[model samples]
Target: MNPPNSLNPALVALDSLPLVVSLAAPIGVAYSGGADSCALLLAAAERWPGQVRALHVHHGLQPAADDFVRVCESVCTGLTLPLQVLQVDARHGPGDSPEDAARRARYTALAAAARQLRLQAVLLGQHADDQVETLLLALSRGAGLPGLSAMAPRFERDGVTFYRPLLQTPAAALRDWLVRQQIAFVDDPSNSDERYTRNRIRARLLPALDSAFPRFRQTFARSARHAAQAQELLVEVAQEDLDRVGNPPAIQALQGLSAARQANVLRHWLLRAHQATPSTAQLAQLLGQIAACTTRGHQLHLKVGSGHITRAGAVLRYTPLGDKAG
Candidate 1:
């Protein structure tokens, strides 16, 4: 983690946000040596000197991974911030993509580092442009409200808070700031690979949209904000209904709600019961079956990855499926 050459606008703007106070325990910044993440490290170190540490995960996919780690370590040394370099093998599973596998490995390394360092929060460099891309990807996949909401500024998982203070900043601004500071960063060649949807969105779709509509990023950001607000309200109402209905709702009680609300309630139930969210198609199929079933004892099984829903005896129960069964 290194401080900027001078107080940049991003730092000034971030400082205006409500400061999250943490004790002397170090704050982890997921430094990738990229412009965006390097900017985040700079801001975190500038704002909370001596309390910020940089953790860089080396995915070992690139030939220059060691060089990237060295750059991260050098930056941290310059700023007098502690650094942790983790090496991870991002091998894809049977049906998994390399990008997805790398992301999972990156987050796993970050979470483990946070626990080892006892950090309160891990700061990420996800900015407004990334948010727009995420929202667009979710929309392309016909995702529901929650998926359309994209990423949150702050969230807790595995006893550590993930913070995205730069969510309101654009990647261009961060890159410009880095250039102004004469900071050299690596540009991953994988970003140009069109095999990934995000790269296609970034290189082709977003640039074309920016040419046609200058404020496309802001528009998508605003849409995500509105969708997030609506999703929050829906979750509140669904939780209230869940409390009233007890553990498993009676078929009569479930059928009393409107189709949309029933889907919302079931979605919430599935999320809480399985500790993982269902894909858009899975949710739609589950809701479709729930609505189409007329007989009282009709059983509908909705499979969500490692979890499944079994509707038997007029009670919808979520159970771990296949090898996950306990």
Candidate 2:
């Protein structure tokens, strides 16, 4: 039999990930000193050798965060790979989710660090369980098609390309491999805190799912892919409609389309052009106002996701939260 960590299940899974980058280009791995990321860092370093670098984001939210950096530094030193540690504030504002704020901060810091280092792409360690959890959370929130589509394997954010290669692999397989190889990894204490919905799902729901469905990971992933395909078609239609309706979307041209198309195109416009998303209530209200505006004297002003969508003459305009008064 082959030695542990040599052509192991976890390593094989990582190898199967269809990455699109030149072999000569450098890559950065988001190392969190956890089992999944540690396994990924080891596999990537083995494959790319000198071309792989570890990028660890220190959110400074907990006292143990400093130990994570020390472990990452030690591992990188042993592998002869460069390690970059970035300090970021992951605090949340009023009515904001702590998880979401930390995620945004981490991504922004990672992108900035990757750009500064001239890395071609960054790799993440999100696995199959995480994907399934995301889908469940979306379902619980009555999310739209985009939310149902879950995480994409490859995505661009802040001009940096990121890839999730382990989405097909299970978390247990990675942990098992790490144990067999006598590798060390720290478990984040927050992961066990049941105060979070995700942790509760991981602890209580996953075991039940494993017992009943057995193949929930593969099946759930298949559904997410189908949703993603449907979302892509919707985006294409929205693009065509926006082209006809105009950038600011002339109210007259927008009213010509069906209510469904109006909603689709408008949602696409706000997200693509203004980086804003409307809540369901906000979109429904905006749609009604657009339908009622037959007279030249009719006015419209509504709040939508950190911005206000108001009628400026014959077209709809988005003014950011700060510029609303102007």
Q: Which structure among the candidates has the greatest lDDT?
A: 2
- Runs in model 1 deviating more than 4 A are 1-6, 276-304, 323-326
Candidate 2 lDDT by residue in tens digits, 161-230: 9988888788988888888888888899999999999999999998999999999999999899999999
- Residue-level lDDT tens digits of model 1 in 34-143: 88888888888878878988999999997878888888888888888899998898988898988889988998889998999999789888888899889989989888
> Candidate 2: minimum summed lDDT over ten consecutive residues — where?
1-10
lDDT of each: 0.81, 0.91
lDDT, residue 23, model 1 = 74
Weakest ten-residue segment in model 1 by summed lDDT: 1-10
Candidate 1 clashes between residue pairs 3 or more apart in a chain or in different chains: none
- Model 2, TM vs. native: 0.94
